[model samples]
Target: MNPYLIVPLLALFLNLSLFTYVLALKGKHRVVHLYLLYAGDLSLWIISIVLYWSFLPIHWMPWIFKISSISWLLAGTLFLEFVFAFLSKNPNILLYLLRGLALAIFPITLTTDWIIGGVERKYWGDMLLPGPLYVYGVNVLIVTPAVYAIFLLLYESRKEEIGFRKQCYLLAFGTFLTSILGFLTTILPRILSQGDLHYPPLSGSASVIQSLCVFIAIAKYGFLEIRLEKIALQLYSKLREGVILLSTADELLYWNESAKEILGFSKSSSAPEKLDLGNFLDGFTRKPFTRMDFKKKSESPAKEIRIDDETIYSTGPVYLEVSKSEIPISGRDLGKVYVLRDITEKKEASEKINMLYSRVVRDLDIAREVQNTITTRTFPDSEKFKIFSYFRPYDHVGGDVLNCAESVDGKIEILFADVSGHGISSAMVAAMASISFNVVSRKGSKPKEGLLFTNDLLSSVVTQHFISAMYLRFDPKTLILEYSYAGHHAGLLLRKGETLDLPGKGGVLLAVGTPILEDYQIQLQAGDRILLYSDGLFEVRGSKGIPMGNTTLVEAVKKLSYQDSDGLIRSLVSYSESFGDGIMTDDLTLFCLEISESA
Candidate 1:
């Protein structure tokens, strides 16, 4: 055995392994298939050389030499096809001409000796002797296409990104090196020495360098689509989200481990290689997904899928937020990339929050109903006075409360209170205040004593909150009004078309402090009216941030004093709403009373 035969043997082994590996890949692109054709040609060339050097019969040398020449002749054409595919470029007229020439000369080389005349016996092995058309064949069929492919690769390298450019440069360098070594060791020597070269052809051995270079490019820089697909598969398998790749024809190109798990494929089950996307989805759900279903899903605005088949998924339920995007190469639609993220936990949590919110809203509605029942009362229909009340809460439930009771001694007791805050907590306090007011009124306590008792009850039970209230008592026989304030605004007394403030001093907020409630007495005349309200009326601020102060309310009351009790209260509320631009920041309550002339 010649020791020099080891080189071509090694080249043969490497190229055959690369070609087999590429062929065995599941989903291969055009560039990878082209590379497989190129590598198979090189492996054939190496195998011919390896057989030529072996101890074969002497008569077979010519046949082996012709096969080797034919392999070399096809090498350049296959490599150019691979280069054009890799660069995503269409074949030009030059490529078509080269292909035509290679195909035309294929039969001639097999039948005649125009390209490979004969084989010469050398010390190492048999060398191919150049024929009459050998130089033209080598230059036009082999060297021309290889050089052109390398030039195109170099030109494309300049326009590519750094990673792809490195891959291009490596492939170009490998092709250039293979061409140079083959030309020097085989073609150049054969042409120069006129078939008297001492050494056998080593172009088969030189192909090993190109193979190794392409391997390096694939391993490190992802030169071929095969490497990128492998890398994408690895990354997708490790992701928590499921990923599925499909060709434009709905062929299942690739699916990661996560996708298999999400689609309910057991570990022991073997997935079919030729399974279409529609069939895969059909197995995943109860209803089969048709081709049109997949197309609509890819184009639809709503891109979510809910899978609740207990038989498919051992778990309770699966909610997937699915998105699809088209994979395009050089403006050509290659495939679709489908990503599915499990949102079961997120959906469950949102449902829990909504449930709690609904429960709270229902409770608030019931509380509002109860509060309206307690606060809305029929004031004593007395001949001496006509009483009217209005209440509006900022929310479903509020802090402001109003209550009126007629004592056995013909004393009409009225209480208007505003708790510190809004919502459920304040509404609770208002309820407590209403009960306390009724209890104190039954005891026939004076206006000042009633407030003192109510403040003491609230201060002991409530924390971080206080109440502001105005308590009024009117004796119909004496025509005298008595009022006391607990950190509350003064009441308005309307007499002879003029507004007067029924002011009281030394009042403090209830529940938080001891109130120094002073009793204020007003000599009520026939046809005179009085109005008491919570601070929400005048504290309202408009768009300009100006509060509608008590002075404004007094002026407005004087202008509207001619209306009856119901009309007066409604008109006042409407005026305040207009002043605040229909935005309420706090609860509002108004109580109005008119003294009849017949009294």
Candidate 2:
């Protein structure tokens, strides 16, 4: 309400509002809040001056005087923090130690009168005589940091651009201006005039110089190009993902820390607005990164670069994935944000995985060759019988066996087996079963005897494993087809185009126990064909997701009556696969034999 209080009250309101506004901008620019905190404290010191220079309640003068010194202490402490950060110095021990000392001094000054001695009223206003240790403590904790800050600015300004250098000079000038004014108005007038004439209001005038720093600090984010909001800038700076603000007019508006380090280069020091897009890519690629294809006006999909070689300006030497999105303001391309992520560990690990995968594939190829040699046998070289064999493993190698051989006595012996499970172990069982079959068949044994020999051969060696096999002995002269099986699929006899099942009327699985082989005999007519297959061929799921049994296989064989032995086997596998929805349940094998009229 007083005339002198008007300007001070207005200054107080303006500073408080500024503090709140800058606090809002903290998410955009963290240091902005520190600047406002310092400025707010300075304003509080001014309010104390306004109170003293007016007709205040006399009792409030001492408390107001004490608080003024408190504001001075806070202003100096907060300003030190702001200055260190503005210089791009990260949080270090030295900074925290200095801050610790300031905090330590804070509790002492609040309780004791080491900072504010006593207040006396003059004709026009009140004067607070300096405390005993106030001058030294205030000068040491507050003014000294500010003086050192000016020297630091000048020293570091050497490598900076013209604009940065100008900002530094302006900031240094403001510091000196405040210090000179404080000495002149707070101390000199009282000492020189040798009277009780003391006016601290003149000390508050130093605030004009401090405003210069705030103005200069605003210019630091490149000439007020806050087109990228403070939130965006803060987010961009903190993120490992970078943000690059390139104005629609080809001007560089912003480049975050990650953008500079990851992209290799930054905006021109001589001309910040004029950025070479080519230079921008140096951070991501070892070679010249010329893939400038995403020039779409709207937001673009992310693009990845897997540089197997060296990289520049990056955190690691291995790999990087970079993406750019055009910043659209009001549906117009205002700039671009570049997000960079370091995929070095993932890239190296993937390369190792691929190398391991290649080795696995190579090993599987060798296993496949060995399994092929063991599972498949030479077909009988005969004129009366046409034997066709089919084998397919679920993956790399299979556990299904198909073999046929003609004995010296003109009797053809055939063996087909499917091991219990799939993969390398089962394929090994199939391989061993084929060897046993070949050895017994060459010995001129009957189908049942050959089955018994194979059962004994696998019983001791195969643990947690068994074989379901069918052995066949066909006499070309007699046209007598004698087939025996052990826990295997029944033979399909297609006699004059009518499907007939031999049934699984056999013994226990081979390797589980001795097998009492039951032979099923069928006389070959003018045109008779028999289908022998492993359980893997007939034990897959049907169209309704039901397990396909031999009956369904025989039905499929019936449907393919028009097909020859080879065509029918091919269609059998195709139909079985269709029911599985393109997935394989087990290793598949189908062995077929047709009798020609020459027999």
Candidate 3:
């Protein structure tokens, strides 16, 4: 083998390698395909040069020279196509026309002597003799298009982003170098010397420099889809979540800064290149990182682990949410990506919130117990009259209070009050109202007088809330009933299947204003029932979003007039609950008084 033949042979090998590598890439895009076309042409040009120098036979020289001519002629058009594809630009008409010209001139070189002309045996090797149109062909077909492609790349690089622009500049510089070296070593010698060149053409060997430059651009600055991979890696490195990539053999391929920080790896030290998954996770945990059992499972849920190493976490124990997912390619398991999220703050905050919530719940339970003791759970019943009361608070504590007591004169005093709202504050107001009622009831005040006294006390003490109340007094022997209201809903009097509203004379809410109440008297016949209730029952909304107003409640009470006092209150509560889908928007209170038939 001649020493000079080694250069073209090596160049041929490099071109073939570049072509094969690009073709073998998975999911090859348009730019890659165009590059493959360019590379294939370049390889052909080098192959023809190698064959021409081999001196195969006297007759084969013309054919090899013709092949070399065709390849070199098409090189510029193919490279321009690749440039356009790389820049993501649509080719102009000029590109199409130049491609057509190259194709049209290719057959001319192969079938006729217009372009290749003839071959001459030189001291170094066989060289192609230039035809009459060879100069025009070389300039028009090869030099012009290659120069234009490099110019376009340089012009477009300025508008690109910093990273991509670097790639474009590198590519342009490589192509320029290839063009300059190829022209000087091959075309210049051939045209200047005609057919009697003393030295062998080194254009094929010179192409290796361009291929090396392209490879450098691909490896360092990232060209084509490799640039996308570089971008992904940069983003992955910046993630707050720790990410670790492992090969199928459990070798550590990649890990981000966050992964190092999470695993408590020394920040100053570099990662070991040959570390396995087990060694990577060794010092991070004591239990073999959940025994690496998650890798065995096809679908694994995120696992929370507590790191109690005081040396790593100075504040306290660190909580991490670790998850693993298999990275598969083309139905084959490539590796696994382990993600670690620092959930220490979230975990601690959640625990603190739960503690506060538990304390509130316990306090509310105690408040409900105290309110239950203060509010009346049972009402006094007698042969002459039967009393029934029901109360349901919207929350753990209620604003509604119902109480019944016998005065010094033996008159049964009943008071039912609803504060402005439900919950702890309102329940406290209800308790105050209960105490006020008890104090006035012991003094044996009249129905109107009792409300006035209760209002006076509440108005002076409570500022944020008010109370609506009804006070009633009954004489068992006389069968007479006296009632007064303070900004409360009208009580219903059920008599002989007729419902009548027992409206108050001066209805003013307590605690907000002075009470000016008037007591009303009604003669109660045997079996007559009076119903007193808070606004919560009628204020509820049904499924159609319509409120169960006072009119609907009065009609419902009239329908259930035949039932006894307890049964009537129970049925009414059930009706309201059913209408509102068992959702209580406010505190509910019901007090029913019935005169027995025997009375």
Q: Per-model C-alpha lDDT, please?
A: 0.74, 0.65, 0.73
Error of 3 at 46 (Å): 0.9
Cα distance off (Å), candidate 1, residue 222: 2.0
- Clashes (N, CA, C under 3 Å) per candidate: 0, 4, 0
Task: Give one digit per residue, the lDDT tens place, for model 2 in 1-599.
Answer: 54555655665665565456445444355566566667777787877777787867667776777656667766666777776666665656655765776677667766777766666776556776556676677666667777777777788766554444655677678777877777676655655664234443455647656664645544343321252254556666787655666555556656676666555545443436455555533343323332322221222233343322422112234344556666543222345555556554334334333333343345766457657666555676667778887888888887777877778998887887777888877766666676677667877877788888777656655676787778888898889888887777567878876888875567756554676677678778767888777777667776687887877777788899778888888888888888777677888777778888666
RMSD of 1: 26.3
**Per-residue lDDT over 1-599 for candidate 1, one digit per residue giving the tens place of the 0 to 100 score:** 79988888888888887677556642257677788888888888888888888867778988877765778878888899988877778899999998889888877887888877887777777766777888888789889998999899899766334446667888889888988998898788867887568776677678887888887776554457533454556677899777876655554556677776766677556554344444444224323222221121121133232222212112244456666777742123465677766555444334432333344355776567647855856778878888888888888888898988889998888888898888877776776677678667887877888888777656655676788888889988898988888888778888887888887864665644677878888889898888888888888898899999988988898899888878889999999999999988899888888899888
In model 3, the clashing pairs are: none
Instruction: Supply candidate 3's per-residue lDDT for 9.
Output: 84
Q: Order the candidates by TM-score, highest first — what do you get?
A: 3, 2, 1
In the order shown, the candidates' Cα RMSDs to the true structure are 26.3, 23.0, 23.0
Error of 2 at 216 (Å): 6.0
Error of 3 at 147 (Å): 2.0
Task: Please report the candidate that would top TM-score against the real structure.
Answer: 3
TM-score of 2: 0.42
Taking all chains together, the TM-score of candidate 3 against the true structure is: 0.45
